[model samples]
Target: MKKSSQPSLLNNSEQKAALPCDHIPIRPGNFVADRIFLAKGSMTTPERVRFVERICALYPEAQLVECPDTPHNRIDLREQDNLARHQKGKHTLVFGEHKSAVRFSAEEGNACPNYWHFSPYGFCFYGCKYCYLAGTPSYWHSPAVRIFLNLEEILERIERVANQANMPTAFYLGKLQDGLALDPLTGFSGVQVPFFAQHKFARQVILTKTGQVEQLLKLDHNQHTILSWSLNPPELSERFEENVPTIAERLEAMKQCAEHGYPVRAIIMPLIPVKGWEKIYGGFVERLLESVPIQRLTLGGICIYQNAKALMEMKLGKGNNISQSLDPRSKIGDGRIRYAQPLRLEMYGHIVRTARKLRPDLELALCLEETKAWKELGIEDRMGHCNCLL
Candidate 1:
């Protein structure tokens, strides 16, 4: 199917003038909201409008509502009043808030996880059986893709921050949705990739399992944009990641991106323990290295979120052999439930060792796991945010 085309939310000056307030402080009872920057694109649909209205009704004290008409950018919610009220210990935002409130926590203080998450669109169009969004409140509704049109403003803010920091900052795109799933329809990468490339302090990393990357390859992009693809074995991709690109097709996209001078990365994440798992994953890694010039690779074992576990079981079938093999575990602060630490370390070690044997120079790291095990691997220094950094 052809991608949908909508008017650029940032292009409408009249709409910008009509927005209630650029910054509305919403404080519903004791729960204070983060400052919600008004992006013209945020009100693209009636549902989105209703969502915003409901949030406003709930919280009347969220401040810093500046409405800039940018295409797809990040709206910082940290500036809202009652910031302390929003946090019950570590969790940010109640689980069952609004459609737009996909729970996320900034790595405040300490070394920020070095991972950057930017979502222009919320939820996803592709319905992967293993998708974690299904567990969140937003997933209960039809998957209507909402593009945050104020992306340009968000980019400008990010650029400003990066300029002041003057360090290599990896901003993650596609946290709330697939980074490139809507690229063909929205043409965001065309504008965003180059923008980040121009800034020396920022590296734009997009993670996707989609093969519709022809638009990206055709662009004369700066080398700073790292095109990372999430790969699973063919069996898993076929069985779990329904309606997405095939493993071969994804690798082909990565190969094309690398060929076009874009630095490429790979993520062997949420690794499911299927039949003949080792041989399947090892072969997949070998095939990946054979196809793309992987600058860095992240190895992650399958980690499900607790809230989503039952849903995943139902979708994949509870009696299925693979589901039966998955053991129950605790949820990390990031919202993903994982296998036991020991088992995860073993799997990570195996993948890292196998990949290192093939390409000694290949940068390898782990995703959202204990740092101590990574340190023991002698590859500790290589660890950074979300395997996109090497």
Candidate 2:
């Protein structure tokens, strides 16, 4: 599909488009979950009960369990990271409530603008081989995917934060989770998109790998929502990304969103330096620029927490390219393991130049690198435009 400079259809109305979801996403992105668990007090309110019932109906075949005393984040077993176990647990879905969902970023040292973010969904079902969430505190104990039932309260918190700010503020949805991975089942986008469209100052930004955008094409976004995808070249994705959509498939979805009048953006992130990387990456960047009408393009390399790195090595072997490439000298500013400064500079510079040479007008930014690195790469002034930022 070719991209148009202007949106083919205006989405600021209730009019729906006859769009197809040709993209396959996540790990069984259209998940028929193995089991569904109702957490403690998950059915307290009528609204909460109704939402649970709606999701449960979608997976009538899934086993349903009632957890009377356990929170959704906690489980009785330690979910092992073996390939077999990792894929198995990803299908486990839990229903719970997070009373407070809005939080500010703490990435002060890593050159981040400290954006405000929220997650109606907890954990991810897409089991990437190098998933950083695997090592985070929330997912370490239990890696099962969850849907937060207190969405109304979460939206209220977001509006409260937006009110505190004098101008338009963005509340990110994919910081802790792939924003739309489970949207087909939860229908969260149908709720959040309209909320942001009708609100005065709140803008929604969703980062995702899912291509089930039928709900988005039908919504009245009013140009208030920004959809970004975590993209990698198909070659590298095959090595790292498991059970996620291909680069071409994501670009197709981006084209549809652009045609339907939604602001689109992408991140070529966690760039792995495979053999003949220059040619492969250069070609990929050219295709990306020529394929989608993206407002911004962000680039980043792998930044793995120690625990996450350990788990990654388990899947890719101790001598994997990613693990071997880590700068043994020391960790970077964010205290995450990364390639040597020079190697990162080389990779970032190559991709940046490739993107700029094709679409110099395209907005650019770096994700999760030190301030000095950005300055050296000559894009320090454009730091805040990265994925999930305003």
Candidate 3:
């Protein structure tokens, strides 16, 4: 039979012109890079050249090194001269082509609706102790922040994949890095928010822990971009999350995005069970719902691979409650350690009940959890309502 000439169902949106590459703006502050390493092939495109020139203008003194391989090679180079020191803050900026810009989640039994994930940047500036990327191959090499200059090609890849798929799909930005952490420096939101806004079949959902929303507030997101924030209570934020935005700042950003007509969501994941967690977390949830009209709220607890667990232990010291709390006897679908089933249930249940009472209309879901957990939480019907999906 001949294939149908019709387009994909989700690909029915009108074609929109992309924002001019030269018009993109940057809000460079203390987050400027010390040096930049560019892949030789990236400079061939005009868009790539303009993006590089923009960065060069911001940090005139930073050295620019052209690598023989794509910038991905520079990030995968495990033997940086001063590896330990570079991971602190004195990091290098590497921009290159993203060869395979879109792919399905390789995670096993991740309850989230399977969709494509692509990042304009990788390995965030905010170094949370329990970062799951720590266990992945990239962390083994270098955790320095990376920004890709070939965004035009990346967006084209998304459009092509969405046109080919049968159902509606979303391109997630937070899986590989904190989506918006360095937005002030890259001004990526200005470009991406509008691209997705115009695309009919493809949608963009960004997740971040940073409060950098100055540029986002001015964008015409057109409801196609969903902005979500990773949050924790004040006590937990002060303890485990260092050098990241405070809860107040993140909540305020969420409020601004919601007010600007952007679909807003929150992921209260890696919900740690520190002492007095129930009362503390319950109160935190109450205040958050009161301050913002959140469209969705997802809950999750400690989920880590062995290597990531070791990295967290090394950074936080061996006796850290995060690793100690995991059930070591068995591994989950993706070979990651997590809190015992009962503990996770209690933690997820607490926040769910607390938020439900305050805002019965709010959508609640889980992250990277298994089928049994979803059934236990009685949210099996809402399985697809995750951070990565609409």
Return the TM-score for candidate 1, rounded to 2 decimals.
Answer: 0.70
lDDT (Cα, tens digit) per residue for candidate 2, span 170-241? 989888888988877766677688778876778999999877787789889998999998888888888898
Task: Give candidate 3 regions above 4 Å deviation.
Answer: 1-20, 23-32, 68-70, 75-90
- List the candidates' TM-scores in order: 0.70, 0.90, 0.90
Best-to-worst lDDT order: 2, 3, 1
lDDT of 1 by residue, 1-390 (tens): 222233333355532312222333232112233344445445665544654565445445644353545322232224332212112111112111122222234543221265555665555556466666655644332223444544555665555555555677667775666788656544567667666655667677788877767668766667878888888888878888766778888888888889999988988878777667778888888888877898988877655655456656666677754466565554455555566666666677777778888999998777766666577677777655455452
Clashes of each: 27, 0, 2
The residue-by-residue lDDT of candidate 3 on 43-98, one tens digit each, is: 76766677677766777777777774655644444444433533543256767666
The Cα local distance difference test for each model comes to 0.60, 0.78, 0.76
Query: Which should have the higher TM-score, number 1 or number 2?
Result: 2
Best by lDDT: 2
On a 0 to 1 TM-score scale, where does candidate 2 land against the true structure? 0.90
